[model samples]
Target: MTTHLRPTDLRYLRLVRASAWYDLVVTAGFATPWTYALLHDALSALGRAWGLGTLPPLDPIQTLYANLMGSVVVVWAVLRLARPLPLHGLLDGTARALFTGWQAYALTQGAPRFLWLFLAVEATFAVLQLAPWYSPFRRPAVRE
Candidate 1:
């Protein structure tokens, strides 16, 4: 496949790459056992201080599932960053939109205030991945 990337496409790709890196770090924090506990404890303390309800501890099964998902996201991000395909941006953007929407809704249902910060990051990355797709002047996709 030959990608005739315009300047905007290059910019979008860069944004995606950065977002991938950010996700890698954030996901790692969740997937790692020690860091996960630390983060949970910290948030719980903060919530208690702020008079919000404390975060619940994750069960073993939930931890396993979260780690598996984190591993998959890492692999997908690496592959997409290495190739920068239009489909990558499309799929990632769509997934991010759904995930962000779900997260925002969950936040409304009594999640921690800090979750909003993560939501903002996800929404920004989703826009970066989607804007080029909806641009009037985008080059057509050509599959070989």
Candidate 2:
């Protein structure tokens, strides 16, 4: 693949960084047990306010998994924020696809209606990052 980045590549890089920033901001708060508790409660309250069912009470295992996911995603987000590249966008989009899939699966399992919001965002980003227009192969080859 071509490493000769183009203007369009720069635009895609921005999208990658932007998505990473979003993930960092949103998931950072879940990296700890205490923060996860707060987030859970806040989400639960928001669900009620919106007429959606409340989330289940936070348990130790749930907290542990949440913290793990948050920590990993936060670290990955920081990587893209600091050194974003087209490849990063492709990989992040791949991860977002997986996330969207799992989120949809959860909903099908009767998780919550509020989850649709997250799924929408995930799927949108995934589509944008993975869009065929950004494929390096489609760009005019750079003459060395």
Candidate 3:
């Protein structure tokens, strides 16, 4: 039996490909240093603000976690690029959930100013991942 390609499927593939490229760039180029710096400052500030003493000097554990997370993102992106069709919905859904959670956390933290940068990045990623380009790749219920 032959399977026919639907417009939605095509769109989904496009989304997956785009998202894969984005992830690769962000993980390797943007997020690595950016997260390290942000985490360092945020943790230091939180420690100082609460008088909990200064954060311990950055250590191997911190580096390991950052590297692991970054590697995971890179691997996932590579997989999406290799198998765009099957991974499209999953990637988009994951991005949406992650961003939504981040938004909620930012709101609850009551540090809107600091969180805005993260919120903006997450929002942009969410929009790009869930755009009509990927709608075709979604399951029937989610497709428009």
- The local distance difference test score of each candidate is 0.74, 0.87, 0.62
lDDT of 2: 0.87
Query: What digit string (tens of lDDT, one per residue) describes model 3 on residues 1-144?
Result: 324334356755776677678778766532365666566667568756865444456676766666776777788778878877644655665676686686678567653344454567666656655544354543354356
Mark the 10 consecutive residues where model 1 has the least summed lDDT.
Answer: 1-10
Please write out the lDDT profile of model 2 over residues 40-105, one tens digit for every residue: 999999999998778888889999999999999999999999999888888998999999999999
- For model 1, name the residue pairs that clash: none
In candidate 1, stretches whose alpha carbon ends up further than 4 angstroms from where it belongs are: 1-8, 46-53, 135-144
lDDT: the better of candidates 1 and 3: 1
For each candidate in turn, the TM-score is: 0.75, 0.88, 0.53
User: How would you encode candidate 1's per-residue C-alpha lDDT over 22-129 as one tens digit per residue?
Assistant: 877777656666667776787779888877667768677766666676778878778876876667777888889998998899888988777777799888888777
Q: Report the Cα RMSD per candidate.
A: 5.0, 3.8, 8.2
**Clashing pairs in model 2, backbone N/Cα/C closer than 3 A:** none
Among the numbered candidates, top TM-score falls to 2
